[model samples]
Target: MIEQKVIINLTDENSNNLGTLTVSSIDCKNCNESRVRISNSLELINIPVVDSADNLTPIQYCPDIGANFANLMFLEETEYQILFESSDACASYDVLYSLTKLNENYFKQFRFSLGDNKTYKIAGTLNFRSYVGKSFLDIRKNKINSIKIPIEVRSKKMDYFNQYSSMIADLSHHALSLIFEVNSPLYQEFELDSKEKKTYYEDFMFLEYLFRNENLPSIFEYLSKNIHSQLKNRTEQVPLSLASNFNQNSLKNIVSKPNNLYKYDADFEIVHKLKGHIPQMIEQTKHDDTIDIPENRFVKYFFESIRDLIEKLLLSSDEGYIKDKLLFFSNEIEYYLSSNFFKQISPMDYVPFNSQILQKKEGYREIFKYFLMMEFSFRLSWDEINNQFKGFEKKLSELYEYWCYFRLLKVLNDLSITKVDFDDVFKVKKDNWSVSIKKGENSVKKFKFILYDNEIEVELFYNLRFSKNSKYESYSLAFKPDYTLLVKIGEHINYIHFDAKYRSELEIADYYNVFGKSDKKLNEEIDKRDSLEEKESIFKDGDIYKMHTYKDSILKTEGAYVLYPGNKTEQFFESDMIIPSVGAFSLTPGNDGVDENNLENFIREVLKTLLFKHGLINLNWKSLDK
Candidate 1:
């Protein structure tokens, strides 16, 4: 007698497990097994009975695990498989698709009960794939839509997510390191006023915590501080004065009589003759050197300047988070200055870069230099600051496109299928897909790469202006695509364009509808919709429509797609086969790397088709599958 058990892992379109099933050896052998189903309503039906047949292993059955099975999530077909062994032979099936949902807008609600009678609502897409007992399904909580597709595509999109998450971490670490290296000397200069200096130290640590993804210690306390406050404590150490020597009645420091009346104090402290009403004297008058105590005098100003510069150079744009930080530091500095501890520092109190005052106060020389560097060194204006902050997303989007380009390059390099002929390969390679990871500051406004050999030519353009010269003059407006790839093989050429979209699902859904309430209220609306409509798209119509316009209007274009941060099950979409089409690639990241994504497979498939079509490779194309 052989004893066996079968377990079916039920998952959604994104391959998130809805439930798990275990059956006995008798159920495995039964050819006409009872059908199990999970509807879009998340209702579980006809679950297999536990221990109907003899149990070989001391395995628990449905009575133990399936008692609370009503809460299983559902999107599409509930797939399962059989696993059994006898003395003679063992057997397994590829995949069994049983349960399914037919409606797209049907309501699906799965109640997951935690301890203490607490339950949570989860939104997900439906996905199906081959089962090999290896955990390939990884699902993330939906922030937009909940309709899942096949598992292979979902896995591919997960790859993009991993790559992006890793890149963001690297950039943040770089920023944090730069902040510490540039601001340490400036911090030490304020050692005379330790009370105020400590506030700066706290602010720096808070920024560090933000980078580390730790909870902020005092968020409300930090934001409540005033940014633009007046300085109060100050003293006039050196009084400014004026002097005169040739006055009659103002003879205060005269020790000798005048030698000549005409040539008064020129020749003689010795007297020759005294003229009528002649009185030789030196007079001096004093005045207070008053100043308004400039707003940018605190050590916090130094930190804010550095941060602003870093954001200007690297980040896409600050979402007023930096302003809140500035407020915290400004309030702390104002408090410190209001006290009797530190001397009031006016704008004139700041020593010039090469002033002899630096020689006298050597301790404050570094401090002066730090100030000069912060204010005068970069000369960044308010307009520039605003521009940099607003353009932060553009930079990040461009970086993602570059990441994709480099990944492709790596794959090509590994295959030894490409001989890259960069634009300036002969001299210095000026026009190429290049990344300048500069420390402290960096600029890449106009950057791109061009590749060519004897057979194939590839142009990877970044932020290429869509003007009349490029034949993209549709609306007489300036439009620059994030990334454009133009490939040429002999006489045949193909253009595939890509645009990086760093939008969340909620954002995409909101884009579909013009007017909306506050994000908080809109979120409530989205949650309610998720329970009702399981298969509806959470994507914005504009995003896909823009891609369609790109492919249709842009000259020499074959296809256009948007690479976004969505967790959709299907990695790619195509509306038409013959005409150029548009689609999207959900590349948002999760914690770990992709488990079994098909992004690589899809790229390979596309490449193989193009290679064969252009006669670049001459082999049995079908054999490439092997």
Candidate 2:
């Protein structure tokens, strides 16, 4: 008999059950029947035969599992073949409509519980296909609407997710990965809109962190570190041909000058454009603008002394020692800049790449403050502060030239040790989408930065390093997830890793295996990292947060999500969240929240670096208080 315990008996013909037998079933190969619906029925007889009025037992109650039974889960009509009739065999099978598969990549699964049923037949299995290829995020197609006009053109927005497990991931990584795993394919076979494709592009940038999805882990190397945070992948496309159809010249124009394509610049674009200029010019200009800043003299002097620091770092340490020093500088500078800022400047002022101010800290501070305050007053006096502030302004900005070099240095450092894979392919209308990935005539300001020390020699070294060793198609796949947060509730803690989720659900075996585990299982993986760094960095504090991405809704499952940093969010998300933010990095920056590429090795390196240099950078990247 088939049951919650196990299937015991199988026979090719129903007549073989002369009386009744209960045996354990283990081998499928030896079974003679193609498939059989075994029954485990417990009987209730008439001891007194009563209705509720008198409290007597009913007559002959041998119940068959009905709709209220596990029957609803078994959409296959023949699932209750024996209960329906012994000789009934339908010519075709019923489309097991409501059966939902788990939202996974390689380990895709479909399941329905025996909610109230007792007996059910195993139906035929369907071949594998992508849900991304089948659904759309339609506002008009309400849940009440049905595609009854089957003969008419049948189109759909992809189902970004596969199932409705009550988990609303809070971290960007978990959220992005969910969407990434759930995103459906946009193919030439379907007739989709230009806007939809544009939405896809925008989502790709924010969620998957990839501007283009022609291939997995595509090189977005030419993009700037500044633009990395806010480069919107908002390109619209109507499919005409495959990727080859994308005008290379158009792309070149797109990369060289994205400003020409858009209607207006948001905070992100302004930063990207300003940073695109020569590092020297950009920083000098920024410095001049911030002359009135409280620590102006200190900052300027720091900039002046940047060269020595770079030399010290370069000479004192080669490839191995640079990471910690870099992290220290990256953290210290960012904290100092963001924390101490009296006023918010343009996006250009927030570049994370800059040289270290290694020596004579006090003198540098004095010089910087004097020049900064003096410049502030000078700029304020002018009616308009455009081209009028050239000459000395340019020279002042020259002090910051080293940041460009540092930005390049970071990119090269990223490239030198990291390995990424783009085995997967995404087919969609080709369009020009760009970022600071450092490819296709990408520029410094476009992919540049501003160091706190603001030194030229350091800038020069970074510039030379990147210009020489780095590819223009700079590893676009390198996504710096806005943040990695850890949240705790009830019995478990969730590590929310954020990244971009570009494509919908494909084949993700590992993702399913990891996310599907219970609380006990999740802790095991955390404790058993292959490296101490991964163990400490990833599990103890936090790691690169690649948010899970999704395809809104599709067949089988309604809303599905997959986490890139499939740590522990799987345990509590929807089960607790009454309403959750679907936006990527909703907890931090770039909150679009869905798409999918977070490099595996890149994640490891992030954890390793973060743990190795705990004191170097200041961040809340730590594990939940479990």
Candidate 1 accuracy as lDDT: 0.36
Candidate 2 per-residue lDDT over residues 109-190, each given as its tens digit: 2354221233332322222121211111001111222111000001011111211000111111221221223232211122
User: What TM-score against the true fold does each predicted structure earn?
Assistant: 0.32, 0.19
Residue ranges of candidate 2 with Cα displaced over 4 Å = 1-91, 94-120, 123-453, 456-626
Full-model lDDT for every candidate: 0.36, 0.23
For candidate 1, the 10 contiguous residues with the lowest summed lDDT are 130-139
lDDT, candidate 1, 499-576, per-residue tens: 776433444554545545467786677666653333333344457666776776666676776665445523233432
CA deviation > 4 Å runs, candidate 1:
1-167, 173-455, 467-479, 503-538, 569-581, 590-600, 617-623
